[model samples]
Target: MKDLLGFGLRGRLREGYTAADFRADALAGLVVGIVALPLSMALATAVDAPPQHGIYT
Candidate 1:
């Protein structure tokens, strides 16, 4: 029972993960970030600023 909840409070020192999981998550995040970047740049330009300024701000 303790093992099921990570050894009764101390918790598991190591957890499981896979390369495919990481790659998929990273790819999805990158796609969303890239999509947001263009819209942000357009908004910044409308406000009379450089595109990168939107990214920084």
Candidate 2:
């Protein structure tokens, strides 16, 4: 995975990312989950159903 990102003639410019990149990615995913929560509720309500039903579907 690191080698793929670093692939290019400009090795210095395209250096592989560190552990910080993975951490940031994980945090972003969590934020996305939080953002989706309300939208999921609204969708289930629109269909006259519970939020967990929407999730299971």
Candidate 3:
């Protein structure tokens, strides 16, 4: 199982995350949110719904 999971499990068991890993995850989430912002608004408009509805989604 360890071999199958590979280097993702490289960290010490007691300290599972590093600061760099946290920063990278936060940046990735921010990017996805930015990209989704306009897309959600467009989708809502296409369906004749309020922009907030897509944002809620």
Q: Give the TM-score of candidate 3.
A: 0.66
TM-score of each: 0.57, 0.61, 0.66
Model 2: colliding residue pairs: none
Off by over 4 Å in 1: 1-14
Q: Which ten residues in a row have the lowest lDDT in candidate 3?
A: 5-14
Q: lDDT of all predictions, in order shown?
A: 0.78, 0.76, 0.84
Per-residue lDDT of 16 in model 1: 47
Q: Report the C-alpha displacement of residue 50, candidate 3, in angstroms.
A: 1.9
**Total backbone clashes of candidate 2, pairs 3 or more residues apart or in separate chains:** 0
Tens-digit lDDT string for candidate 3 (1-57): 564556655544336777888899899999999999999999999999998899989
Please identify which of the two predictions, 1 or 2, would achieve the higher lDDT against the true structure.
1
Arranged by TM-score with the best first, the candidates are 3, 2, 1
Q: Which ten residues in a row have the lowest lDDT in candidate 1?
A: 7-16
